[model samples]
Target: MAETKGLGYELIWKFDMPTTINHIMIMEDIQYGELIRKYKVEGKVNGEWRILTEGESVEHKRIQKFDKVEVRGIR
Candidate 1:
């Protein structure tokens, strides 16, 4: 994916059934320099969107671990 240049972007994944999420990983193509300076990982919990983790920056990769949550979708 390409940078949005301040417009920002969002990507989502949906499962056929609720799946327990323990952690997430995000990566940037460092060959072009890290463009992602901030990001958030959220999960759909109990029909509501809840922030699972957030960060200030991500270079080549970032991994976030959190208490397992069951959800049907994530973004």
Candidate 2:
């Protein structure tokens, strides 16, 4: 993945069926110092993409929580 100037790198995950998601956790290898400084989580709902969680200036571990939502795709 190539990192952009401001956008950074983007990764996506898709599922065949809608899955219930309540929490999301990201663990980065600390050996490389800080890998991700900012991140966002979005989900596809009712044919539209929505932001579920986002943050700025993260370090080794990041955990986000929200109301349980059923999603088929996430980025």
Candidate 3:
């Protein structure tokens, strides 16, 4: 688990090669208003970055699934 105390922080993951991604899960500590309330998930596809999912006022545990997409990185 990772945590940031301020706003505008980002977490990213990079893969060695293109891979299919079908699901994403985010876990957060229960910190009320201090928790992550909004976030966006993006993936690199065909040399371009695209948004796969986005949320506002999110909860402690969030999960998202979509049609498998080829990607080399996510943030």
Top candidate when judged by lDDT against the true structure: 1
- Using TM-score as the measure, name the better of candidate 2 and candidate 3: 2
lDDT of 3 by residue, 11-40 (tens): 767778898989899887776444787889
Return the candidate ranking by TM-score, descending.
1, 2, 3
* Model 2 ranges off by over 4 Å: 1-8
Using lDDT, rank the candidates from best to worst. 1, 2, 3
Candidate 1: C-alpha lDDT = 0.82
Residue 27 local lDDT, model 2: 79
lDDT of each structure? 0.82, 0.80, 0.79
Clashing pairs in 1: none
Per-model TM-score, in order, reads 0.86, 0.82, 0.79
For candidate 2, what is the TM-score? 0.82
Q: Candidate 3: deviation at residue 57, Å? A: 3.1
